[model samples]
Each structure stands twice: as structure tokens, then as C-alpha cells.
Target: MSYIRGYDPETLRELVDARECKDRLDEIGEQRSLPALLERVWLLKVLGRLEDALVISEQSVRVARMAGTRKDLLRARILHASVEQQRGAFAVAEQELTTCAAEAEGKGWSGIAAFALQHRGKVFYDAGDYDAARADFKQALFLRQDSGVPDAQLESTLHAIEAADQRRMRASVAS
Candidate 1:
């Protein structure tokens, strides 16, 4: 079982107790394993410790490059870009995610491609580019569907699409 729980589908932000995350982090102390580092980065990001998250995320990317497979590197890059995105480095996150998505697709890794596209859509959504966000989400949904991912994963993209549409409608109405 995973220590992490209750992350928002659209934003991938944790909705569980911060104390639980802190406890998990403590348990993972001094562990430099890729999974351990990735968990630390995620917990830090969710706790609003963006600087620490960024540093750890970069380290995770380096570790993945040195010891992990290409897929692992892509996942690490995606996580690092997410930290960048939360740090308000929208352009950097967008560029990285775009590249990750393209690479995943080229490698015939539909699940990884969908993951990258979903995150890229979030970057666009956070930047107020709802149309682009929706487009990416749609593409991700297609990929996920084609890849026969679980219902929860498909629902996440579906929820994202609905959210983008709602936000777009709201912006138009307010304008």
C-alpha cells in the first residue's frame, strides 16, 4: 500500500493530512533510492516546500538518468517539471512536459505519453490557457482509452476536461 493518499485528480495535489506526509518523510529519511526520492519530492511539493521539492526533483532526474531506464527518466522529468510548475515556472514546465510527451509517444509508451500530456494540460490550465489545456486533456483521454487504462485514470482526464470546460465558460461569461 502507498503512504500517499487523496491526491486531487486534476491538480495531483495531496488532500490528505500534512502530518501523515511528514511522518512518511521521516520514515523515508536518508533513503536515496529513486522511489524514496520521488516520494520526498512529491510530499515536499504538496506541503508547499517548492524549493526543497525542486532540488530533490532535480536530484531524482539525475539519479534516474544515471541508474534508471528511459521510462524512469521520463517519469522523473515529469515529476521535476511538476515541481517547476508549482514554483510558477510555467514555461519551463510546459517545455519539459511537451518534450516528455513527445518522447513517450515516439517510444510507443501510451501510458507515459498520457501521463505527460495530462500534466502538460495542467500546466496550460494553470497558465489560463484553457483551450490548450482542454486539447491536451482530450488527447490524453484518447491515449488512456486506447491503452485500456483503469477507470480511475480515465475518470481523472474526464474530470479535467470538465473542469477546463467549466473554467472556460466562466471566463467567457465574466468577460
Candidate 2:
């Protein structure tokens, strides 16, 4: 299946008001489709409705599994991990993303694996584990390059790796 475009939760959050985004997501989520549900899950996460987002994220995973599309399943799993990360359950989020990354790797889905690693890197980043985050982001960048992902997508990970490196250096100096 072709990737559905323009459903990035962070982008949407910045583009629209929370209430308006929620209303639109609610309408779209009525279908319970993978993309719609996942988008809603992300928006709710941004809105700080962790419990609701978790429920929907879990549902998206289940639905995506039933749908049997590797990309969708991976994306749903990644989003679930992201919600956990947002809830400050960094360990759980890392574990979830680790599993997803392993599964994607096993399936030879490099893009999915890269995406999972990128999110796992984010989990580590949020926990102030800059070294680990840098490692993950570096690996993710390699994977994205191997998989021929867009340069636009790769740039953020590069920036993140640099930022992680800077943070690590600063922390070491401070200590």
C-alpha cells in the first residue's frame, strides 16, 4: 500500500488549534481506519490526553495487525511507543520501539526499522541518554540512506544526532 501523506501529528499540532484538531480527528476517527485512528492517537497525545491516546494507539495496533500491512503495523507500533514516550514511560517506550525495530529488521523492512530506531532514539533523548540517542539516530540515518528515504526525512535525524552529541559533550564538561 502506498504511504498516506500529511498525517504527521506534530505537524498537525502546530498547524491547527487543539480543539479544532480534536474535532476533525474525532470525525475522521469514526471510521477507525489505521491512518485515521493513528492520527487521532497522535493528536490526543499532543493534547496531553495520554489515557485516551493510549487506548486509541493500542486499538490502532490491533487494527493494523488485522489489516496485515507491514508498514501500517510498524507505524502503529511506533506510534504506540511514542505515546508511551510522551507519558514519560521511557523504558517502556524504548522496549516497545526495540521490539518494533527488531521485528522490522527481521522482516527486511529497513524503512520501518529506521523509523522505529528514530523513535527509540527519541525515547532515549527524552530521558537525557544522549549517547544512546546519538547511537540510535546514527544507525537510523544509515538505514534511511540504505533504504533511499527522502533527504528531508534524513536531515532531522542528522540534526538530532548532532544535538545529542552537543548535549553529551556539554554534560560531560559540566560533570
Candidate 3:
């Protein structure tokens, strides 16, 4: 998401508006696909607007409940956790991720479950609980190893954890 280019500040502002337009379907009583809602939420997330993302995503979660699609609910839950993480609500984010992962574990969505674990690990890392973060990361790594996800992204995530650990250690030494 961060890799996408040409999302200049002006474009981001416009995009934020567009996403709001799509997100307010209740005003028009016009139906929107779950994917459409998710896309808007994702764009808002990439724009670094976590509050907006949370608003739209919570609406989407309600819609998903009405739609009664387990998969859609799963996606919404994961995305909601991600937005909370972006807002630095680490405990709330971890709770959401943990709930989603537990549900996914029983429903044969281990890949999605693993993704939730990554989010959980990130929250733990940001909260400076690296022991818990390492456990979550190790579990996620094992899942990804068997699940055949693209290795490059996982490698980058691992490296991010490593870098954060290094920084924390340096800060401790300096203290």
C-alpha cells in the first residue's frame, strides 16, 4: 500500500473525499459491494487517515453482518484491527486480531489467521513487548512457510521486527 506512487497530497485529499462518497450509501439507499467498501477502507488506510478508515470499516462490518458472509466479516474484522493499530491503539488492535485469528483457525482460513497474527505481532512490537511479538512473529512465520505466501513481504516484515528490536536495544543502552 505504501509502495503505490503518485498518491500526492492533493490526490490523497481527493481520494479521501471519494471514499467518503462511496461509504455513505445509506444516504442514497444504494447498495455497495463488500469489496467496494473494503477498497475504500484500504485506500483511506494507505492515505494515513486511520480515523476515517475506522468509520468506514465499522460501517462495513455492520454491512457484513447484514450480508451474513463469514469471509466478509473476517476481512472487515482484520481491517478494523489494522486501522486501530495505525491509531496506536495496540491493545484494542491485538484483541481484534486475536478474535479474528481464533475464528479463522476453526474455519479453515489459516492463511487469513496468519495474517491476523502478523497484525497482532505488529501491535505487540509497537507496544514494546518484543517477547510476545517474537512469539507471534514466529508463529506467523511458520504458518506462512506452509501456506505458500510470497516470501518477500514476509521477509520484509521480519526485517522490520529485527530493526525495531535493534533500535530498542540501543535506546536501552543509551538510557
Candidate 4:
């Protein structure tokens, strides 16, 4: 029932199974705790339920604001920005991610900053800004390396960098 195995960035399908995601959603039904809401938002987003994800993400943000620490609120905001990115709100997502990354960096939260940078890179990639995406991914990789994150996490950023490079090359060739 755990979804961690289904989140592999290196996989062709990104390791997500829609049916499993839906089952997890059902299992988390009406659980309004912050962690539950966060998980629900992630499941809904993965299930391609963007509107529902956005709603749940917003509620999670509100909950974090009311009952969580600054780090928790930032994490919620980062997740919210990711949903916005997936929903094609590139500008909004980028702005929020920029702010979040800056705050996290200022606080010496390398892992959080790397996470924000990685997600921001995805926004850039989706928006066809491959240069920016690569830059963000590289920065995230550096931060993660400095923090001695697991190899799997490092591999994710490395894959992102390669993807951005490939896309940029393809775009230039087409141009």
C-alpha cells in the first residue's frame, strides 16, 4: 500500500500506477490531518485530478499555516506550487518556488532548498525553458550532494539535468 516505490523518477511511467493511486486516495478519505491532507493532495495530483489536488493542496496550506511550524508551511507551499505547476500555472508556480527556495536557503535548510529547486526545475521544463531548468537542477544536485543525500535522490537530479539538456538540444535543432 505504500506509494514510495511508485515514485521512481527514473522509470518510464515515473513509477505511478493510477489504480494504486486511487486506492490510496480512497484509503485516506476524509482524513483532514496535515499529513493525511498532504498525502491526499499528492495522490490526487498523481491521479491527474488537478482541480481536486489544488483544492486539497490549498486546504493543506491553510492547515499548515494554522498549526504547523514555518518549515511545515514552507513544505506545504512547495507542494501547492508543484500542483500549480502541473496545472499549467507556470508563472505562479515559479514565483512561489523562487520565494520558497530563497527562504529555505536563507534558513540553511539545504534539503528543503534543493526540493524547491528541483520542483522549480520541473516548472521550467514544462514551460520549455530548458536552460533555466538545467540550471535549477544542477543547483539542486549540488545542494543535495553537499547534504549527503542518498544516491537515489542524487540520481533524480542527475536525470533531470540530462533531460533538460536533451530537450534543449532538441529545441535548438528544431529551431
Candidate 5:
């Protein structure tokens, strides 16, 4: 069954229809066309349908693995972690991100490592562990900077740091 769900990206639509995505996944057989299937997964993610994304991502990972594309498999795993993070599955998200991070570090994929750090920091931020969040964000900032990430990402990460600090301040005030 192909995993081609009827996905409307508008948040208002919010119709991920995991069944549809799952059905469409079977469309991509062992023909060696990964990018197209990856597109469908990306669309599901853009539409805020995280569970669907995870499902499709898993399928893509399997395809990549069977196709001998280890990098793409790792990408799928990292993206799955992102979905978990969004769903507040913090520990699970950390496990995914940590493994990806380690792989990135070992493979010298600085860009991937930086992205993992940023996403992990977000998980920490949502968990209200400001200290851990700050550390993660700072590490991300440094990694991105060292990796020559674009200025836009740098600015956004800086804003995230500020936001994390403000949240910590609010918590202190409340306490």
C-alpha cells in the first residue's frame, strides 16, 4: 500500500490522514527513487502531521537502508526524533537525537550535528529544563557558527537562546 495521504499543509486543514500516507508509501518500490518518496514525507511534516511524518519517515528509512543509503537512513531517524520532540516525547526524542548526534560527530557532519543540537535544545526548552536548554542552544550556536551555517539560522538560534533565558527568568519569578 502506497503512503500517499491527502495532506493539506495549512494548519487549518490539519488532515494528515496517516492511512493515506501509509497507502502511498508502497508506490515507491525498489526502483532506486528515494528523493520522490522523501518529498511526500516532507510534505506530511510541513502540514503539521507529525505522526504521519514519522510513519512515512520510517518507511523511507527502510527504503534507504535496503538501498544502501546509510546517510538517508540516518536522516530519517533524525527526522523521527523531531516528530517525537514535537509530540513531547522528550526522552525518546533525546535518544534519537543523541544517536544521530553521535553519528554526525563520528562522520564529521558538522551541519547535521548543529541541527541536532538545536532540535535537542528545543526539546529541553519545552521540558522546562532551562539550564540544559541553554547549554544545548549555546552548543548549537557554536557548532553552527563553526560549521558556517547561514546568518539566518544564527539569528534564529540567538532568538531561541533569548527566549529560553526569558523562560528561566519567568520560572524564577514564579518560584
Candidate 6:
């Protein structure tokens, strides 16, 4: 039931078993610890439980605002924004990421700022704004590099930029 206790962060991200995460959530019952709630929100999102994920994300943000650190609140907002993005609420996701980016920048948390920018790029990508997405993705990659974040951490952003470039090229060709 508490199988999540055994999985390291890298393993949780790369090798999450949604069934196991779900089982753990069910067994953990009503006492949703912050970490557990965040993990469950992620797993629910991955499992296409969008409605459930959105509910948990909102709860996480609300709880984090009152009882968690700044970093925790930022992460909660990121999770909420990601779920909103998946739910086709691009504007909401963009707004959340914009707030996150500004907060992280003000706090000098370049890595988190980069992450928020990357997610904002994703919002643009979802909205078919390939040019804007590529711009944000490129800026995020630069910020991550400047922050000395690991290359692995920036890989997805690089890929997003590449995808946006390709899409833009195709659009130019078609027109």
C-alpha cells in the first residue's frame, strides 16, 4: 500500500506504475500528506483521470498556499497548471506558469523559472502558437543552461523547441 515509500524520485518520475500509485492512494485513505497528494495528482494525470487530477491539483494548491513553503506552493501551481493544460485550459495554464515564472525569477530560483517558462511554452504549443512556443522553449533552455541545471533536466525543453521549429517550418511551407 505504501509502495511509494520505496520509490526514489527518479524512479517515481521515470518508472511510475499508475496502478501502484492508485493503490497507495487508496490505502493511505483520507490523510493526504502533501507529498503523497502531489504524487497522486501526477499519477492521476498520467492515467488520464483528468477530472480527478484537476480536483486534487486544486486541493494541493489550496493546501500548499496555507501550510507549505514557497517552493511547495510553486510546485503545486505547476501541477495545477499542467492538469489545466491537459484539460484544454491553455489560458489558465499560461496564467499559472506566468505567475510561477515571475515568482521564481524574483526569488532567484533560475531553475524553477526555467521550468515555468518551459511549461508556458507547452501551453503555447497546445494552443498552436508554434512561434511563441519555440521562443519560450529557447529562452527556458538558455535559462536552464545559465543556471547550470543538468542536461537531462533540459532535454524535454530542447525537444519542445525542436518540435515547434519543425511545426513552424511545415506551416511556412504549406502557406
**Best prediction by lDDT:** 1
User: What is candidate 4's lDDT per residue for 1-175, written digit by digit as tens?
Assistant: 4555534443212457778888888888999999999999888887778999999999999999999999999999999999999889999999999999999999999999999999999999889899999999999999999999999889878888988898889899999
lDDT of each: 0.90, 0.82, 0.71, 0.89, 0.72, 0.80
Q: Please write out the lDDT profile of model 1 over residues 14-132, one tens digit for every residue.
A: 47678888888889997999999998998888888999999999999999999999999999999999999988899999999999999999999999999999999999998999999
Q: lDDT tens digits, residues 1-175, model 2? A: 2122332322211233666666766677566777788888877887778999999999999999998587788899899999999888998999989999999999899999998998898888878888998899999999999999987678777777877888889899999
- Candidate 4 Cα deviation (angstroms), residue 164: 0.3
Q: Evaluate model 5: give its TM-score.
A: 0.75
Which runs of model 1 end up more than 4 angstroms from their true locations? 2-12
The model with the greater lDDT, 1 or 5, is 1
For residue 146, give model 6's deviation from the true position in Å: 2.3
TM per prediction = 0.92, 0.83, 0.75, 0.92, 0.75, 0.83
Q: Which pairs of residues collide in candidate 4?
A: none
Better of 1 and 4 by lDDT: 1
Q: Quote model 1's TM-score.
A: 0.92
**Which model, 5 or 6, shows the larger lDDT?**
6
Worst 10 residues of 2 by lDDT: 6-15
RMSD of 6: 5.3
Which regions of candidate 2 fall more than 4 Å away from where they truly are? 1-20, 26-29
**Which 10-residue window of candidate 5 scores lowest in summed lDDT?**
5-14
Give a tens-digit lDDT track for model 6, residues 47-116.
6789999999899998999999999999889889988998999999999999999999999988888888
Model 5 bad stretches (over 4 Å): 1-33
